[model samples]
Target: MNVILRRLGMALLILFLAGPAYAQIDTAAREAYLVDATTGTVLLDKDGERAMPPASMSKIMTVYAVLDRIRQGRLSLEYTLPVSERAWRMGGSKMFVEIGDDIRVEDLLRGVIVQSGNDACVVLAEGLSGSEEAFANELNRLADDIGLRDSAFRNATGWPAEGHVMSARDLAHLAHRLITDFPDHYHYYSELEFTWNDIRQSNRNPLLYRNVGADGLKTGHTEEAGYGLTASAVQNDRRLILVVTGLESQRQRAEEAERLMRWGFREFENFELFEAGAMIEEADVWLGASSTVPLVAQNDVLVTMRHAAREEMTAKVVYDGPIAAPLQAGQQIATLRIEGPGIAGHEVPLVAGVDVPPAGYFQRIYQKARYLLLERQ
Candidate 1:
């Protein structure tokens, strides 16, 4: 199949309003990243790719690794692990477990996700790999294997270590994976609070109590890393992932996160252009039993654009004129290109909607004659 591209029109350029531009957001956080999950659009990015101290936010990977082990049957939530002297002695938010006591994996998960307990992280690290050093190695290995190219791990607790680091974008990617990969266990992050040994601690995540669609995520802070958070939310069926770091204080971190989430939800809208297998258009068939065959999208096409734009989208459907038969159903024979101002363009595969066999000799002759006549007209 051959395909051609043509510029639809100039009207679509006006999709982004020209007056003073869309409202700009200024953040007090030293680094930030926001993405429209539905459309994969980077709505806001500030040093998103720069590797920096991720603080407790790095625990997301620890949680991820443990959850993966659970999924692989290497570990179970009910399994109990001995708290090492090292874990018990670790400072910063504590789950308050005795050194000799055995703690359930599920409770430790809560300690990390809800309380940001450094001790809990240590317990998990030691329990999973027999030592934090080995677990850190696994962290680096898993990070490289999973496409987190810029992140490096020194330890599981995000305690002040020499080379512990991750990027804002990397954290957002990890958050996406956690949500999509472990739906069964993701509820732990959203839990408002977790209690153990008669002591209860509320989740540190700032978005949970807000009316906004914020659900689950992790928060981090260290003297060196400042404050950081990797947050995700679903509003009106649209999900967004945001990562922010290097804030002066916890208040700034919480405020900045909420503001960014609000802006992402209010400023953009998701448009579903075509559902999977939905006919996009029709293309003429050359010397085929049928005159034409439908061109359908292979998957749902969703685009994100500014909420108040006035211009209609421009779409170009390109394919070889009169595709030659015998065509097979679901064969990719065309391309659907869509563009809009202030939104990234999309090129999606277009498939043949149905089978089209080659025409008989007489039918081929007649089709050729008809084409010639139409050309003359």
Candidate 2:
């Protein structure tokens, strides 16, 4: 079958008067990070990997571990766990549970996520692992398993303890996993308030109250760590994860998070080049039953480009042509090179769409002679 190659835009005709410009705006936070969640592109990073106290933001990891256990069928949300004296006496934030109270796992989750209750975190931890120390170990183990190397947990409550640290990048990554891996439970973070023992505490996450499409995540604060927030927002089907830490005040953390998210969505956009299994071009086949085979993309080709410069987008299908048969389906035979304004060129794999067996000897001889005559002419 014949396939027509899609023509790329004439990008050379357009001149980019300036170099690629990302947001150069200053933020009040000591460390910050932003990412395009859908494309997995890091749009901004300012000391994002410098490990420091994450405050209560680390509680997201504890939530992740609990959700993972539930997913594995080892625990259930309805199961009740006992509150220890350690949980009751904890300071910072409190869900107001008394010692010996049996709290459902789901309510505890709400307390930890929505209320940012240090006491609730301890309760869940001790109940899950018999002691807070064992739970901290489990937290570290889970972090390692999930590739969060830059983070460590000394306790599940993020209660200003020594050696409890997480970088802004790591926090953003953890937020991504929580949203992507446990969609069912992630809604707990977006709950406006949770009440236990007649004490109603609102979610500390500042983005929830803003006009932006911000949703679930966490906020953290301590005298040592300042204020920090790990936030996510979805606009126009594109989601972004942002982390801002060490701001002077809760107001600054909220403003910085919102500003960065706005910049990310305004400056960059995802451009769809081709869908998966779409024929991008055709590749010539030598000594094959068919003279040509279709080249198709293995997955969707989405490129992040500057919003002001998407018209400069262009793409080309490149391959060493006239491949010798027999060719198998799904064999990688070409590369789809794409380039656009304010972005580096990227290559995606293109694979053979069908199998092709070698032609009979006489047929090959005739085709070769025909090729030689054509070349001479």
lDDT of 1: 0.84
What lDDT tens digits, residue by residue, belong to model 1 across residues 1-377?
A: 12333231211111222122244468887888888876787778888899999988999999999999999999999999998899999988888777889999999999999988889999999989999999999999989878896799999988888888999989998898889889999999999998887899999999898877888899988888998889999998899999989888878888889999999999877777678988777788888999788889878977776667535556667776677889999999888766656445667778999999999999999999998997798
Tens-digit lDDT track of model 2 for 237-278 = 999999988888877788878888888888888877679898
Candidate 2 lDDT at 72 equals: 98
Question: How do all models score by TM-score?
Answer: 0.87, 0.86
Model 2 scores worst on lDDT over the 10 consecutive residues at: 7-16
- Residue 320 C-alpha lDDT in model 1: 66
Best by lDDT: 1
> Would you list the clashing residue pairs of candidate 1?
none
RMSD of 1: 4.3
Candidate 2's C-alpha runs over 4 A off are: 1-23, 311-324, 337-347, 364-377
Candidate 1 C-alpha error for residue 12, in Å: 14
Cα lDDT for residue 172, model 1? 92
